[model samples]
Target: MDIDWPLLTGLIGLCGVGLLLAYSASGGDARALHSQGARILISLLLLGVASQVPAPWLHRLAAPAYLLTVLLLVLVEAIGAIGQGAQRWLELGPLRFQPSELAKLAVPMMVARYLSDRPLPPTLRDVAASAALALLPVVLIAAQPDLGTALLVTAAGMSVLFLAGLGWRLIGLFGALAAATAPLLWFYGMRDYQRQRVLTLFDPERDPLGSGYHIIQSKIAIGSGGFYGKGWLEGTQTRLHFLPESATDFVFAVFGEEFGLLGAIGLLLLYGFIIGRAMHIASQASDGYGRLLGGGLVCTFFVYVLVNIGMVSGILPVVGVPLPLVSYGGTSMVTLMLGFGMLMSIRGHRKLWPA
Candidate 1:
């Protein structure tokens, strides 16, 4: 199988950096680091398997994959395990996994499948059908009260639409509609805790010991890091356990506090390179499905980085979005690797004309 070495290199670099930061954030404990290592190995194996699958098979499987995920989401509401005050997980004997993560992959696949054969710019009916395919998963996810995952899943499908020749006017209209509905979302759609998060974004100090604690501590950790940082394993906020979710959602704060501003920029540059490579692959895609799937995955990856960093830096409300490939989590890592593997599948399975 053909390999995209630069993309793999970027992924490996991020995973390695993630391990180090996770270890540091754990106060020299090797448990999280070790778990991350195992996850990386498994993720790579999955990537290999996915890379060998033909694009046509993926296209054919899209409908079934999406339908299965939809069923899982419904099951989640019925009998799923609850954690962090949300029913987002399915428990089966010894295995537990989030159905919402499946939507991340399936939504894009189905959107691409729908638009691959249809001529675009899509007609109004086509747009409505695509929206139904996308919104069904998004609405189900929001019902679980997992806003971050919901938004990401929605973006995955929207990215496909955007790449499928959605018009600029439609884009602007959607943007305006979303803005107009923001207040309604805040009042009726969002949970009380979620609303508090938004309010805290403007002034975290107002409730330093309540809903605002996380961002407040995050800002402290980041700002405390000077030019070259306080040195690895020397981040006071993380070591002292003052930072919340340091090894997961706020791992960037651990990185910043220890490596400083320069290191943060370097991390961003690494992510930028990864996204750039994905976009390049998308540009070279052999079909509409490949193009839309690749571009959507890349866009979703961009949002992961943007949301995680934005929340940590106090620029956006605190959401439980983990740093892509850099945060400690098995599900997120595997979900992302699946996308990358599909990307490689497209690249490797393309028909090459004789010179």
Candidate 2:
């Protein structure tokens, strides 16, 4: 099968940069660097395996995958492991995993499958059903109090709806409805800490040592890094432990602290190339399933980049969103690579099927 050379090249570059950033963030800790390296290797292997799987196989599995993930999310609520004050994972025997991560891919696939051949500008009923399909897991995940993952999953589902030709009038209507529900959601749905985050975005200094600490520190780290940065492993905020989650959620701040504005822009450009290539592949897909799935995945990937950067730069609330592959998270890296692999499968399968 033909390979997507540009996408692969962009991934390699990002992976390299991720390694460097992780190593520096860990303060020359070889163990952390090695662990990240191992995950990247595994992620690359999965990407290859996913790329090899035929689109027909993925299409057939879409519904089952979505159902299984929903079940797992329920299971998480029932018997999931708790970490960082949230019950978002299940531990069975020696294995522990986050079911919400599964929804990131499953929700999009199922949405695309449901909407693939549906009439364009779907009726109100169809839109509601699709929203239910997407938001069902979102509700379960929000119960996990993992608002970040829930938002990401919703974004992935919405990407499919948008690509499937959901009309602007309906989109505007939904937006208005969501806006109307914002207050109810804030008071009844969002956790106290989540609300604090929203509030903290406006004035992080209001609680500089409390709910706002993360944004405050993150901003300091980013701002402290001038044009070329403070140089690798020399970021005072990170090395001194002033920055929280330096290896994960705030890795961008660590990167910005060490590499400066130029490095940050370069990283954004790299992500831009990756997203562009994925969307291009999506456009070239041979079938509706392939096109919608590819496009949904690309759009979801874009959300990850946007939210993470926005949060770190203090323009948006901190929602525990990681900086895509660059952040030190195995689950996210693997999930992202799996999406890329599926994109490759969609692109490569097109020539043979030509449907």
Candidate 3:
């Protein structure tokens, strides 16, 4: 099978930059650097294997796989391990996993399967039902209080719905309703920390040294990076432990501290290339399932980039969103690579059978 070199090249480029940023962010710490290196190597292998799986296989397994993912999520809640104040993972002997990662794949499968070739302009009922289906996993995820991942999964589902020709008036009305509900959700539905994030976002100096510290320091770090940065390992904000989650959610701040605007712009361009290739592959898909899966994955990936930069820049409240390909997490990497692999498989084997 022919490989789409552009996708592979883009992935490689991202992994390469991720490694450098990870290493530098750790202030030259050997263990963190090596651990990140190991993740990159493993991700490369996963990407290769994922690229090899035939699209037909993914299509056939779509329903069962989605059901399996839901079951896994249930199992996680029932008898799962807890970490960082959230019961969002399952612990095996040597493998701990987040089932929500599974939703990234499953949600797209279900949506694509539902909307594929139904009709160009879906009725109001169809749209409402699809919206409900999209929100199901999103609500389950927010219960974990992992707002970042939930938002990305929501984007994945919405991409499919949007591709199904959702009308603008409905979207506008939904936005208006969301705006109307924001207050009620804040008072009745949100947790204390979540609300404080929004409050702190508006005026971080209110509690400049406590809960607000992260956003303030992150902004400081990005500005500290200046036009050319402090020359890599010379960043004071990260090395001093001022920015929270420096290895993960706040990696972009560290990235800014070391790379400056030029590097930041370069990183954005890389993301653009990755998303562009994903869309190109989605366009090449031979079936509706492939189209939905491929398109949904690319859109989800775009959400990661946008959310991370937005939160870090203080335009949006901090929401635990990790900068894609740069954050230090095995689960996020695995899920992302899995998506790319499926995209590659769809592109490579678009024809030649039950696709």
Candidate 4:
């Protein structure tokens, strides 16, 4: 089998956890479990198909895929469905999906493709071009006010540049520039509620029933779990519906409240193993494009996990990043699984690529 079993096993384990938690969070709602299960199956199937695609094919498709995704994003801006106070999703007849999710893959693919043909440690011009490719969709997504996806897309593209051996001096310079623009983004780019989320992070009690409600409840649930947890389906916060978005963004809190500290450690270890295996695969790539794409995808996945856990634990401001493979969402699940499939493709097709 061309499949990387350890990575596959780790992914399956997380999906299983998701199903379990979803069942509990929905208060044993069979429809919710079935819906999530169907999406997982579809995503896994796509992963299988994506794993069989050759590297050259992936490289060949990068530009067109990216262009098409960008176009879709534009279409979204014009006619996208409004949901949850944001115009982020597009509905085409029977289908409804977020173009921002596709941007997560497309931006990195485009960046890796551009950088692979250039010299190692790209020149300023090359870096500028790659950043442009990245920022185009980022600007569009951010305009949709999907700040979380915008940040992830930015991370996705930037990870490719970093993997291409962008220098420490340039990294430092850009970091400073970003810091300098932070206040501008806060004042000009952020919406009112977005600003409130940041403020709520410091003192959730400031708006306990408003912007702070989500994180505050999340913290209480996680803290109540203690060492051994309250036990499966026995989570008081979840059972009583005190935790908001229990099946989606804040699902980790429900997990903590039920499974405790030990379960959380186990979950993190599983994530670590998957990340370690994927990085190893990336390291073994036969060509620069493979390395860049694989590494960038892995880094994006890492950020997804980090941000979700951090937000749930009340350590970071809630930016609405879902836990990879665990959060109950079709678009995020499909996007992540597709990236993993590409990682598997890099591993499977390495020897076939030209040196």
Candidate 1, residues 41-135: lDDT per residue as tens digits? 99988988898898778888899999999999999999999998899999999999999999999999999889887988887678779989999
User: Worst lDDT window (10 residues) for model 4?
Assistant: 53-62
Considering summed lDDT, which 10 consecutive residues are worst modelled in model 3?
114-123
Tell me the TM-score of each prediction against the true structure: 0.97, 0.98, 0.95, 0.99
- Candidate scoring better on lDDT of 2 and 4: 4
Q: For model 2, give the 10-residue run with minimal summed lDDT.
A: 116-125
Per-residue error at 168 for model 1, in Å?
1.5
Residue 294 of candidate 4: its Cα lDDT? 96
What ranking emerges by TM-score with the best candidate at the front? 4, 2, 1, 3
lDDT of 3 by residue, 1-355 (tens): 5678888888888877778778777777788878888887887788789888877888777779777877887787688788999989888999888888888888887787777747756678877877777787778777876787788888998888877778999889878989999989989988998899988989988999987898899999999999888877878998888888888888888888888988888888999998998898998887877887788889889988899999988989888878888887677887898888888888888885364
Number of colliding residue pairs in model 3: 0
Q: lDDT for every model? A: 0.91, 0.90, 0.83, 0.93
> After TM-score superposition, what is the CA distance of residue 307 in candidate 4 from its true location, in Å?
0.5
- For 1-355, candidate 2 gives per-residue lDDT tens digits of 5569899889988888889888888888998889999999999999999999988878888999999999999999999999989999899899889999999999999988888758765677877888999999999999988888989999999989888888899999999999999999989988788888999999999999999899899999999999999999999999899999998999999989899999999988999999988899999988888999999999999999999999999999888888899998699999999999999999888876536
Task: Report the C-alpha lDDT of model 4 over 54-136, residue by residue, as the tens digit.
Answer: 97788888999999999999998999999988999999899898988998889989999999998888999999999999999
Candidate 4 error regions (>4 Å):
none
- Model 2 global lDDT (CA atoms, 0 to 1): 0.90
